[model samples]
Target: MARVRWWGTGLVVLVLLILGLVLPLVDKALGSGGTALAAGTVIAVGTERAGARPVTFTVPAAGWALDEARSSLTSNAEVTRGEVRVDLNLVIPLGSLDNRRLWDGLGRIVAMGGGRLPGGPSAVTTRHGTAGLTGPLAGHGKIGSATVFTKSDLGATVTASGPPDAYGRLAGEVRAMVLSVEISP
Candidate 1:
């Protein structure tokens, strides 16, 4: 009886030791329960076509995850970190719309959705010299910015927003991510 008790105790300890060592590794591989993405992860959106320019961007820091259910297309992606959310979409303009018009259209779309773009568009360029415009987004008790980059008929729009505090906290990283966006021709 004494020997059996010792063996059972040893087996239990071994199982616990193994679990302690393996759980962390599993968490890392699965992105902390298979939702969060590690920092510096590059995400690609859009399908490969003859003239389709795909958009790709990197996660600026930790605590971001791909919201798979909300992201249902090759031309769009949604990522979230806490209360902050960033959405990227690839669009084809219906007609020849200049940068300013595109920005206005985007603002109108936001307003239709019960949101508003409160400020004028500001020029922003990507790392690869893609010219774009960004403007302040407000309404629905959240604050953010909307940026649009265009090449020919292809357009990439990025919107990042969250509650005031969370938006402020992640604003820098979010901006970096936006600046890091690249549209492959």
Candidate 2:
């Protein structure tokens, strides 16, 4: 009985020593791998055709994952941290439309109807061209905003929403992403 007890204690001590040494190494490896995955890398969002300047933006790899259900009409991704969920989308105008008309029409589509948005429509400009921005619209169940811009024959829209305070915090990063968008001239 004494010998058996000694063997059991020795086994427990060996297991504890192995775990203590291995756990810190595992943690360190994961920490560095996360930074390496996100470092200076920007994902391209848009079609790759003969000549198209797709929007490119960098997102932290740890908290964000690219949603895979995108279709021709909507190219999008999502990021979540704590209580906030942000949906990033590049909305393509359906069918064929002239550049001038599309630019003009953005307000109508985003407005949805009069009295829907807090401040109605306002003129805005992006790296690509002049755009219409609207919302944090009323009755949307969440704080939200939309930006409409054009590139060559394509029109793009970005909509973002979350709890008002959290959404406000993300606004700068969102704008930076939008500004980084380069449309082929």
Clashes of each: 1, 0
lDDT of 1: 0.84
TM-score of 2: 0.54
Per-residue lDDT of candidate 1, residues 1-185 (tens digit): 45445888899999998799888788777653225788998888888667543778899888788888788558788899877889999877788856687788888899899999886888999887888999888989999989988876678889999999999999998898889888776
After superposition, the stretches of candidate 1 with alpha carbons farther than 4 Å from their true spots are 1-34, 50-53
Residue-level lDDT tens digits of model 2 in 1-185:
45445888899999998799988888876542212224334555567656543554455334543444432322555544433444445545677644345534644664665414456456666555545454454334556565556665665555556677776776676565555544443
Q: Clashing pairs in model 2? A: none
Error of 1 at 138 (Å): 0.4
Q: In terms of TM-score, how similar is model 1 to the real structure?
A: 0.77
After the best TM-score superposition of candidate 2, give how far the Cα of residue 176 lies from its true spot, in angstroms. 1.6
lDDT of each: 0.84, 0.53
Query: Model 1, residue 67: what's the lDDT?
Result: 88
What's the CA error at residue 99 for candidate 2, in Å? 7.6
